[model samples]
Target: MKATEMRSDCPISSSLDIFGDKWSLLIVRDLMLHKSRTYGDFTKSAEKIATNILANRLQLLEDNGIIIKLPYPGNKVKGLYRLSPKGVDLIPALIEIALWGGRNISNTYDGSPFLKEVKKSKTKFLKKVMDDLLEEETNIG
Candidate 1:
């Protein structure tokens, strides 16, 4: 979304403007767990996002520089999606939200190793996540 497209001057509003939709963040969450994913992978998500909406959200993310679309090796018709630096920056917020849910919601994530690591030491977990992403980025390049 462009600056003029924002609903207001508030930072939160601007962020919501870009990714307020229900599916965008889920898409980001999937990207966080996997360095790269395919369109088919997204379609297979438990959320069952429709193909059309998936295409639109993917386009919006790419347009906003939150994600990058790379050609799938040996498959001209397929593409791989990966988080951009801007997208990776959302990890902390995602982690906080996950923690909030774990505290207030059900035990859905109680068994998740990622949340366990985060609960153990958020700083260390975040550092490791960033380092891993950087390593993947370097290897990709």
Candidate 2:
């Protein structure tokens, strides 16, 4: 299903419809942090996502314009997935969620380098993330 065809009654629901699943957001997190681009990269994550589920989530992300698949420069048969502008815009939301979890939830994912960077300089970190994402998008295009 396409994002355009999703319900519009509640904005939150609309977003949830597209990215409600645990694995999908995790995939986005991996892209945002680890710069994981290939299917193998995602499948080999610590969460150990199943192969079929990973494939489905990747397709969903691509269909929703959250990511774009580009041919690996050296290998036409293999492609790398990178965040689209729409996906990059999600960084602030992800950061906020991570901050909330760190504050309120015990035993949260503890080793996030990005979260540490945000803790040091939130404004600068966010700006840098946007700049980097924009640069990547420009290069890809």
| Tens digit of per-residue lDDT, candidate 1, span 10-101 | 99999999999789999998988877899999999889999999999999999998899988878999998889999999999999988998
lDDT of candidate 2 over 17-116, digit per residue (tens): 8898888888888888754378888877899999989999999999999988888778877888888888888888888888899888988866778778
Span of 10 residues, lowest total lDDT, candidate 2: 1-10
Model 2: what TM-score? Answer: 0.88
The CA lDDT at 86 in model 2 is 89
Q: lDDT at 130 for candidate 2?
A: 76
Best by TM-score: 1
**Candidate 2 colliding pairs:** none
- Name the runs in model 2 displaced over 4 angstroms: 1-8, 109-111
Determine the backbone clash count of candidate 2. Answer: 0
Best lDDT among the predictions, by candidate number: 1
Worst 10 residues of 1 by lDDT: 1-10
